[model samples]
Target: MKYSIRNILNSRSKANGNFFMEITKILGHKPKNTSIYKKAFTHRSMNIKDSEGNAINYERLEFLGDAMLSAVIASHLYLEVPSGDEGYLTKMRSKVVSREHLNELGKELNLLSLVESKIPSGQFGENIHGNLFEALVGAIFLDRGYKHCEKFIYKRVIIPYVDIETLEGKVISYKSLLIEWCQKEKKTFDYNVYEDTGNDDVRHFSVKLSIDEKVVSKARATSKKKAEEKASKRAFFAFQNRISQFK
Candidate 1:
């Protein structure tokens, strides 16, 4: 019995040591509170609870990190683009903190490798990467402070990816753009979505995007939103010349 306890303790000690080294490299500074960092990578499936019965996971931290990211990015935009109006600044910030962009950043950092969960890692969706990234930001905030959080964002997000010229031209959401264009042109549009009848093991959804009662594009994906986005992308290219002018 003593041997088993000792072995367990040794294993956890080793894991914590490795985690500290990895987190230090990522943060560019040693974490004062390592426990918070662990919570950041914890998956809800683990069902962990603290002494007061509060659930221990990354969800709450994700929320904090998201707000921090927005604040820092918004502040940078406000100072950098003095001529930008409210709408312009808001849109620019949205583009910078878009889900797709966050996912890309998370993937680049390989944050998924640090997650602790009861479920298989392969079963997790792509958004998990972004969630972990945000949780890390939250952990940094709690461990160090706002300044450290801002510094990390500048290193990971601003200095590397925030370019006004490129961001202005980037289309974060084709669906939003298509809808806006249709609204401006006073054209009616419809998206006929339904379950795909494919024989693949994974169920799928299909979308047919019609503009002005004429089918402009058809696409299929694992979810309704993805299928719609795919259709919207095809439709965007179809009406590229006109849409470019409208944009």
Candidate 2:
């Protein structure tokens, strides 16, 4: 029996083609240039460099993606809510594009599965998903142009996820709300954050939420901002009825 080299090469090429097809199915479009996608998934820890010795990682793409997301989301909100003032539209866009929301979207689509990183996924914080989502958006923009990028956002985000009524009521930052309420009520408020210096590997912060010189709530977290935010959230719920009237 004669084994032909050409036949073996053709079989391998066919397998590669099938792999790309699977990736296209996952991405919802056939990739025009695979290199863009490759760069999107590359992690900074890998220390990859381009032809000019410039760092080649997702960070730059993430920046571009963030701007692109804001633009698309802003346009959508502007057109959909005709009665919405600038402030209202901006808030609505923020609600949709918040880091928490983006992270949830990325996780739902398993975007992290495509990331190329030296660090273990378990070690990464929740923001990794959001960052990767932004990078992917940037990649799509570069590979396919603005119109295709807009189409992708419309299909993946607006069509399935956006509900104007639901978004309007969503709270992106309880801390901001608490502060606003305090200001409106002519009451003084402060977040006193202190180092926890606990036995845990991660540093911790303790926060006391003071309303009118009295401590309303106390909480601790891995970061001072998070601790303060948690305390403020608790303080808000404690005064929910009063806050609702102010809103």
Candidate with best lDDT: 1
Each model's TM-score, in the order given?
0.65, 0.61
TM for candidate 1 is: 0.65
lDDT of 2: 0.78
Candidate number of the best TM-score: 1
Model 2 deviation from the true structure expressed as Cα RMSD, one decimal place: 12.3
- Which residue pairs show backbone clashes in model 2? none
C-alpha RMSD by candidate, in order: 11.2, 12.3
Q: Which segments of candidate 1 are over 4 A away from where they belong?
A: 1-11, 170-247
Q: 162-207, model 2: which lDDT tens digit per residue?
A: 6675587667777998889999999999899999968778899999
lDDT of each: 0.84, 0.78
